[model samples]
Each structure stands twice: as structure tokens, then as C-alpha cells.
Target: MNWVRGDSLGHGTFATVNIVVPANGSTFFPSPAAVKSSLSHNAGLLENEKEILSRLGSSPHIINCLGHDHTIENGVEFYNVFLEQAAGGSLADQVKKHGGSLPESFVRRCTRSIVEGLRHIHEHGFVHCDVKLQNVLVFDNGKVKIADFGLAKEKGEKHGKCECRGTPLFMSPESVNDNEYEPPADIWALGCAVVEMATGKPAWDIRDGSSIWSLLVRIGVGEELPKIPEDLSEEGKDFLGKCFVKDPTKRWSAEMLLKHPFIKVDSISFDKVHEPLSPPSPSTHFDFPHWASTVTASLPSSPYSDEWPGWSCTPESRLRRLVTDKRPENWSELDGWMRVR
Candidate 1:
């Protein structure tokens, strides 16, 4: 089977998935060393990643696993793991396309999903050391799933090296200060993700890289953070502030974010604002072939069946609704296409 290449939903600095045929495609990070090797092995970070994904697999908030793509041929190979696709797009794109500022209520819903995914992984004895807008995947049906296992760690495990594996802007001060880190460190990253989504750019993106770390250091110690636009709702600012707590444990959890009052105030037509087939610029990028087949794919109509492999969450709902629908009889339809919203 071949994954239809829509656009890059996401790419890992350490590795990238080939995006074969698009319902969630394979994770090619630990791609086989060579076809010569049967049962090819993973080395370095890839090995550590294997352990993390094993733990995350136990969580429902994370992507569902279809199985590892270990098939190999002469000089050719497949990815190590396969997962469901997020047809909606990444949180990064959503925030960008929506004018760098999202409604306070929407931010709440997205934040709730993030914390839930974090909670799910951590409860299973793992920490998603890397949490950021780029790592959070959203679907049109309002479902959100966490991705990027390269920076994850299990509970009780000793902190690892301080190498820069995650996006610099989202790195937690605790993670940078100590060579060895823990779950608290991840909470800091989550704060950055929330702030960026609420404001449209990273918390420290405006600063220089070398100095940015220094700036984060200041914020880590309870220094006054930069001003959030006044026009943003009070509820939005409040939600953003909750995650910005200097102390990681004190920060809100996924369940708490879901219930926050800020996220409850949706615009009159907020749900309707995210209609499919809308134009996507640099921001609002998507990986859903269903939308792409009509807009960018330049096809006369949707190529896949209305009820093919994707989630039951309708594209019309704008991903505000949770896709509680149980598994369809089949799910491989979303396998290979990457599209922009």
C-alpha cells in the first residue's frame, strides 16, 4: 500500500516518516539499518524511543498503534511503528491560521486535550519530556493526539542528557538547568505550548536563541512574563496564566483545563468558523487528504469514500467535538495522504 503524500503534517529533527498511503503512516525514525539485516535493530536515541512508545501505547489519548512497520527488502525498508492520522492538522497550524490568537474557550479545549494526553502517558509510567504545539496533533472531529516519542521518558527512570532534542522555544527551564530531568520538566514545556497557542507565537520566539534560554530562566523563577494582548478575553489570559506557573507540579492538569471557564465561552459561530475546504496559507496547514483532494489536490471531488478509514468525527464539526465513536470496521483509509486545511 502507498500513503498519498499530501504535505508534511510534521517532521522530526531526529527522523521523519515517509507518509506512505495516509491514514496514520509509519514512524520511520528507527528505520532499518539496511535490508541486509533481518529484525534490524535501533541504536542511540531510537532505542530509548522504543521504550517510550511502548509506554505511551497504553494510553488512549495518544495515537492508536496499528503495529510496527518492520518489513524489509533488499536495500529497502518500512517504518518501525504505524499510527492513526490526525486529519484536522497540528496545533501549530491551527494557531497560526487563526490569526495567532485563538478564542479563550478554544484554547481551553486544546489545552485540555494536551494535559489529558500528558496525563495518560505519565500515568502509564512515562513522561513526554517533549510537549509543544508541534507535538500535538488535532483532528477535524475535535480529537487531539500527542506525537513525537523521541523525547519521552518513563517514570522512575533517571534523567538523561541535556542535549537539545526538543524545539528550543518550548524547552522547559528545568530541563535546561539540570542534566537529568523528570515529569515536572515536561509541565514546563506544556506551558509553552499553551502560551504559544493562545498568543500565536512561541513564548520566547521574539528573543535571540542564546538569550532566549536566559529569558526563560527569568520566567522560570516567577518573573513577570510578557504581556498577553489585552483584547484577548480575561478567561483566555487566566487559562494561559495557569499553565505559566513557575512550579511545574502546581500547574493545572489535563482534566482541570477541560473544565476551566475560559474554554467554555465559544463565539456565536465558533464551531462553524472551521469549515473544511478553507484556504490555508503558511499557517493552517493540514494533512487530511479528504480536504486536500478537493482544494489542493485539484480533484473534482473527494477521492476517498465518505465512510472510509478515517474517524467518524465529521469534518464539519471543526474538531471541537471529541471523537468518542468506537472504531470503525476498518481504519486504513487515512494511511497515506498529507493535506493542508
Candidate 2:
């Protein structure tokens, strides 16, 4: 709690964030921190954020809450919370620096990290009512962590109109309709964040200056989902499909998504160790159209059972499938693309 305030990081409607250094050689924390504070009259929001961060405990993906304190200036009291300072700044800052969009590879890596953080939050029985790129912070090591918990609530907590939370641009369908939302709502916001990362634009086009009410109407009642980037790979499209499901119960959970094909990283060997090489003096290349019919001409359309044949009904089983698949050479020879694991 003993600290000296430094430069301002940013200012919000309710609070101002400033850099903090330990006071009088205090060793409470070695690293610098960002302190969020407001005058006594407007301290409730910042105080609530401090409480939520404390309850969530420490995780590499969640911002660390070192402590809190109070100070008096001109006879006015101010309350503050000491938060881990993200050296690389907010995710929004990164997008801006990258010219309003990031490469697909960078988007995938960042999305994986955010999903891991969301999984931890949901497992801990809390909902991050606000999940947007602005609230995600990037560290020096390129690691991203979720921050700004002033609107977070426990699972299944009813949200009345007076307590409606989060930014309109990222609000889920349920949130837009009735202000009733849950952990799945956060997933919807996460999907929006991914689109922003890929296109360097808000998930929905807001530049035309449309009314908020009209935008929410489209989200809550429209048949179509936000447009997915055409340039994305099939696996990437499928990953987003899982996020944009209209039914919250059907939407993919963070735990399930951690096993998805798009985000999983691994190395696969494409060459067969013992394959005999033929002379390559001629210009003719290998064509499998006529040769492929030999193996599949007589096979049933649906060869396998309803469930995946080799994978058992377990989370770990699904996650380990690609890593354990031994036919890497065959996979490489096919038309489909392969990612690093």
C-alpha cells in the first residue's frame, strides 16, 4: 500500500490509471504497477474491481492484484487498487500498431491465450461480463492477460436492467435482448474479439455511424451471424462457427475449444522413413485419382460408427488424437493443409 504515483497510463469515465512506485524503500512488490483510483465519491466501481480480482486469485493469464490503499489530497480521500502493468499495453493498442489488423498466425496465437484465460475464469465460477480486446493486456513476453473486472459476476447471477454490464459493441445476443447472460455470453464476446484481431476492425461495422439500438436489433434477432473472414482456413472457420452458435448451450466451451484443430500446435513428420524412391528423370508426376479408387471404390459411405473410432469419450482422448495419429506421411500427401501440430 505504500507507493508513489507516477505518470498516467489512461483515464476512464470513473477512474484514472497511473503508474506506481514503492514508497520509502518499501519492498512489498519489486515490479512497477498501475494503480486505478477515483475520488471517494466515485470509488465504488474501482472498489468492486479490486474485490473481484482478489477473489479470482493469481493466474498467468489474469492480471495480478497486488493490493490497495488510500490517500488524501486537499482533504479529499481517494481509493486505489494496485494492478500488474502490461508492458506491451492493451490488445487494442497492438491492433492499432499493426495497421488495424493482425496476420492470421498472430490472431490464432493470441486467441489461444485468451481462451485459456477464459477457461480458468469460468472454472472458478465467475463470468467476465466484459470480454473485449481493450480489456486484454499484453506483457513483454507476448503473453496476454484479461483485466478490468468491475463488471464480473458469479455464475448464474441474475442481471437486472440497472446492472447491465459491458460494451455494446461486444455484447452477446442474450445480453442485448434482456440483459440476462452467463459464461456463454463471454464466449460470444471472445468470438467478436477474434474477428477484431483478424480484421483490425470491430466485429460489426460501426464506422457508418449506425444507431446502437439498430445494431443490437441485428444481433438479437438477425438470422445471420457476423461475417467470418473469407481468407481464413477451413479449420479456422470451423473454430469460429463453434463460437457463433445462436444457442448458448450449443456454443463451444473454452475447455472444448482448447482441443480444437485450429489452435492446437504440434510438429508432424511428412516423409516416410523407409519409402523407396523411383527415378525422376521423366516429367510425369504422381496422380492418385485412378489409384485412389482401388482403396475406396467398394467401401461404405459411412465406414465408421457414430463416435470417432479411435478416440474414447474423454477430454484428454480428443486432445491427444492428432498428436498420436501415426499416419503423418499419408496426411501430408493428401490435399488438406497441416499446421504445426
Candidate 3:
């Protein structure tokens, strides 16, 4: 399908995501699609993502990849992959918009979607090495789909002993210590994501000046587990308990988690209880001390190899503030947008 790219939705370390519309004024293609593009020379990750998405096939819980192709503009060749646009942005954005955390019911709904997506990925012999809130997109129809396959790998894929592929905050113990990236690692990350959704904070208590070495030690060295949120339901905590087991083998798989009481509600029951009468107000008692603010830490080169340069510890609230501050007044307007080529 011929399409035209609009303004960029966002850009990450490797590629830019732009809103795309079907060209020739046709409605045959999915409305409000997105195109992720990168310079041909640096498009390996994007290409890999497309290939992985193709292998995963169609699942309601997984983002749909429409197509992929190359285009040349201004004498520069670019690689682009078309995707279904999630109108509700990302789960991280949702957590921030809801004032740092989500209600337990909402968290359950989102967790179920993520588990289904992960189950599908794992059943196909793949592991989503990065399964965090930022990679889970929310749709307008009150659904969530797992996105971003840039770090995905087939089950049992080997890597350099010192290589770490996911965000440090969400890395599983085995991943941090043994360089293992498998389905269990994804489950660990999912648990971390669930904690973020329920508590409005990272699973591990990472202070402003925490060093990468210390964080890595906390995750990899001991029998430590991310603290379960006190306010969560007992079943919710139990579900997380299954996910946060220090032993990856004991950690619950996506298939098992789907049946856990925390997220086992049927669709009909979920729809009835999912919609809140009013938006949940932010809890004023929850303290936001200065130590919880944004932090940037440099990864020391000695302990781990130089493969990883550094990482940032930006909170979702800070990211939400940035987006609100920079968003255009006419941001909702989608018509008469510029074309990609």
C-alpha cells in the first residue's frame, strides 16, 4: 500500500517513528499507521525487528507489522517498516498520565495483555529480551500490545559473556550475572513492569546517585528480589512472587501467569470491572522525595566490557513532563500532514 509519512511521533537511539497515512486518499490500508525508518547503513536493527515481527505472526496482544520497504529521498536511501499505530501511546505514558501509577484492576488488564503477548512470542521459540512498560503500547480500544522487537532473540541464542541487552532496571538476575537471555528473562522484566504500574516506582529501589555497579550487584549477586508493592492485592503479590523468583527456573512462565488469579478474569468480567467511574486521583500520601528524581549513571568499563557505554535513569513522570512541555498546541490535528517522500 502506498503511504505518506507525517510528523514524527518519537525517535529513540536507533530509529524515528512517524505517523503515516494511506496515500491516494484510500482507506484500504489501516488508518493511522506508523512507519519506523532509519538510515540504510544503520537499519540492521529495524530489519531484524521486521523479521521477528513477521515470524511472530498476527496476535491481538502483539503489534501488527504491515509491511517493509526502502525509499530514497534527497539522495539518501532509507529503510522503513510500516506498523499499526497505537492511539493510546505507551503503557509508560499511561502510568504517568494517571499520576505515576495505575489502579490494580487496570494493572491486571495490562498485565494479562502482556502475558498473552509474551506467551505467543515464547511459544514461537522467541524471547522478547526487553519487556517493559515502554515497549507495551496502549490502543484506543482499551487494549495493549507488546511492541519493539529490536532486542528480541530466538530462545537459547548465545551472546558475548559481558553483553547486556535490556534496560538495566528491568534486567533479570540471570541476565545480569550469566548473560542469559531467554523466556524467563522476559518474565522477570514483566514483573518489574508490573511493579512500576502498581507502585509508580521502579521495582528495585534505585536512588538518584546509585552506581551501575551497585545496581548490577543488587540484581545479580544475591538472592534478592524486587519488593512487592504493599498496596497490591494478595493475589497480585502472589503473581509477582511467581515472576520474581531469583531462580529463573522457578519463575513462572507467561502461560502459567495467564492462569494466575491476578490476571485470570475472563474478558466479559474484565470489561465490566475495567472501566472506572472516575479517574483515580493520585495518592497524596505517596512521598516523592528528591532522591526519586531523574538520574544518569555511567557504566564503569572495568567490571563489564566496554560493549555498554552508559544508561540513563529517567523516571516516567519526568518523561511525561517533557512530552507535555514540548507538545504542540495543535498536536491533535492530523489532517494535511506532510508526506514522507
TM for every model, in the order presented, reads 0.63, 0.76, 0.81
Clashes by residue pair, model 3: none
Model 1 stretches astray by more than 4 angstroms: 1-14, 22-50, 58-60, 73-79, 160-165, 208-229, 253-259, 263-274, 277-341
Q: Model 1 residue 50 lDDT?
A: 58
**On residues 201-221, what C-alpha lDDT tens digit does candidate 1 reach at each position?**
656535322343454356455
Query: At residue 125, what lDDT does model 3 achieve?
Result: 94
Q: What TM value does model 3 have? A: 0.81
Instruction: Write candidate 2's Cα lDDT for 112-186 as tens digits.
Output: 878888999999899887787777887766677898777777898874463335655677888767776688988
TM-score, ranked from best to worst: 3, 2, 1
Q: Provide the lowest-lDDT 10-residue window in model 1.
A: 291-300
lDDT agreement of model 3 with the native: 0.73
Which sections of candidate 2 miss by over 4 Å? 161-163, 265-341
For lDDT, candidate 1 versus 2, the one ahead is: 2
